[model samples]
Target chain A: MIDPSGWDLPSLTDRWRSATPFGHVAIDDLVARAALDELRQGVSKEPHWPNRGEIFEMMASGPPQQPTPRAFLEALGGPAVRDALAAITGYRLQRVDGNSYVYLAGSYLLPHTDHRPGVDRRIAYVYYLSPEGAFTGGELDLYRCTTDGSGDIVATEIAATLAPRPNRLLLFDVGLTTLHQVREVTGGARISLAGWFY
Target chain B: MLALHRDVLSTDERAQLRATLDAAGWSAHDLADRLHLATANAGADDALFARLLDLANRTTRPLRLRAFQWLRLRRGDYQLLKHDARERPPAAHVELIVDLSAAATGEAELVYTDGGATLFYVPQLPGSVAVIERPPALLRYQRYLCLRVADAEVHRLRLTLA
Candidate 1:
């Protein structure tokens, strides 16, 4: 059974609708045991070859590349999350692509946008899996892009960040107005599942 | 801002061009000339040039509706270069990584550059996504973080192509 406790879906839908540049709806305890077990088994495994600039950092490149499978991604953006997305946009959702990253202590992620040019990205969903007390200082920053020229306040927008919440998922539109990046993980490992919806 | 040129380049292509422009110190006039040439030889010269010119004009205009199409496509790199040129730093180049365990706890660092070598983070970099802040207690009900930096500085670094 799915629980909507602590979440006001109706209000969240409105938030998504009224969001500037981009908006996000978050899920708590998104990672269930079944999902985590599947993810653990699939660690270090690579998905099919990503098209162009689709693949960023390679987990397999690290000291030990774990085996991650399609099931892992599906678990990250599971039925519950998809249902929420469908409710928000009134459209069925599909997983465009998914990837994962692992950060050890003292490691940091340079700030950057996810989807590249010419890519057909619609929505982006991210799930954080940092072990409790295992690390510190990893956060996702979402920026609202605006233009201020001369003495005029021509344009304004909103940008929000979601901290590293264990078993939490964040869903948002990946449009131009949605400018986001991840901050470096300071002390421990920060694992995440990020991909887009077409 | 400029109007949506009927012949505005594809969103992806436009984004690529914008990233290139940001890195190369190119201008609208330069982009306009290139757009003209790119569309001129594509066989539908008039329609394409008209669109390009429209885009240039609309983007130059203040309102975002004029550039909504590109915006929908998430052409932020271009939008920043064309529109937010003068905004100062606090802007950042963030690269997100998912750990092998698929967790959100890990160590990461910011590396700045100036067309030469990937420079180290400096207080003098003009702008940077320097720090992360804790959310207000009222908002702690959810997981989230915010970055601080000058908007101008984020654009100042210009993207370095692969």
Candidate 2:
């Protein structure tokens, strides 16, 4: 059901294993165009709850119970996909948790290392649903952080940035150094399927 | 930064401190109703904070230490954050917050790519106070208090004490 029709997983996994800072991989046109269009339509129709907090801004919908979302989830949670991800990251794949975010203008996610106790989130991924160039200023910025002489966590600089494009999938492990934030959306809407493989 | 006064609070200052603490404890809802985002009137609260800071810093004062300890337990991660134009870090500032949980301890300093470094670490025990002296040159300076606790027991001491 995932329609992994485009990606060459073996090659992609190798690149991820050797990438800098920590292991991560990405691919564009991840889902088949027609299937994605249908999924987008189904996702847009769901009731969303607005999240307004110091650390996050955007609308969120719980994981789907219906078929469209179920199929998408099925693909991610499927054995082939899970095994490929595990082989790439050198971690066991027990489950994949999924949700979605709808970020409109002025919404942003501030910096935080997404490490919480009891949630053994090994890998985090985002499947872009919004078209590229349809919006501006919603790039995922990853920071290079270190504890300075004083013992405070200082984000020295932005090491990598990934712009959102429709049907692109981004996978990054939840390492101690994995500090990232979503820059404020200056205009229009940016939607994406967010998940974590644990 | 908290200005410490080694001298005891004057009668008038003590009365003011009691009144202010009582207002903060009782009229909290009323005050919140009138509060605006990112704005607060420190008023006499500054002096009280300075006094409390002074009391906590003097290791020899056990009575004052216990009082300050009680305040910390009652008020979780308590802080008075301000960004007045007059008291600000110079360009290349890093506002740092270190949480003061009873058993937690540590500090951090950041060095910019230019080789210039600024210290933003605060003492890591309860009642430790420090101020952000400048805004960072590259990124937005974040103002906050980080409360580090050793265990859940330390976090729930307020209930036990009450």
List fnat per candidate, in order: 0.00, 0.00
User: Chain A TM-score per candidate?
Assistant: 0.69, 0.91
Best by lDDT: 2
Global local distance difference test of model 2 = 0.53
lDDT of 2 by residue, A61-134 (tens): 88875567768878898887887777677888888888878888766676556666788998889888886677
Each model's lDDT comes to: 0.41, 0.53
Q: DockQ, per-model, please?
A: 0.02, 0.03
Task: Output the lDDT of residue B1, model 1.
Answer: 8
Worst 10 residues of 2 chain B by lDDT: B153-162
The per-candidate TM-score of the B chain, in the order shown, comes to 0.17, 0.25
Query: For candidate 2, lDDT tens digit of each residue in B118-142?
Result: 2232333333333223333322122
- Local accuracy of candidate 1 as per-residue lDDT tens digits, A1-198: 234444577887887788655667777775466666556455535332322111122232222234444555554356775676777766587654666667554333333345568976767877675556766766766765553554332333325767777667777776544556555455656766666876
User: How close is every model to the real structure, measured as TM-score?
Assistant: 0.45, 0.56
Kindly list the per-residue Cα lDDT of model 1 for residues B1-162, writing each as its tens digit: 001112123445444434543444423211200010011111212453344334333434321111111111011111221222232123331111101111112111222333234333222111121221111110001001112111211211111100
The CAPRI-style docking tier of model 1 reads incorrect
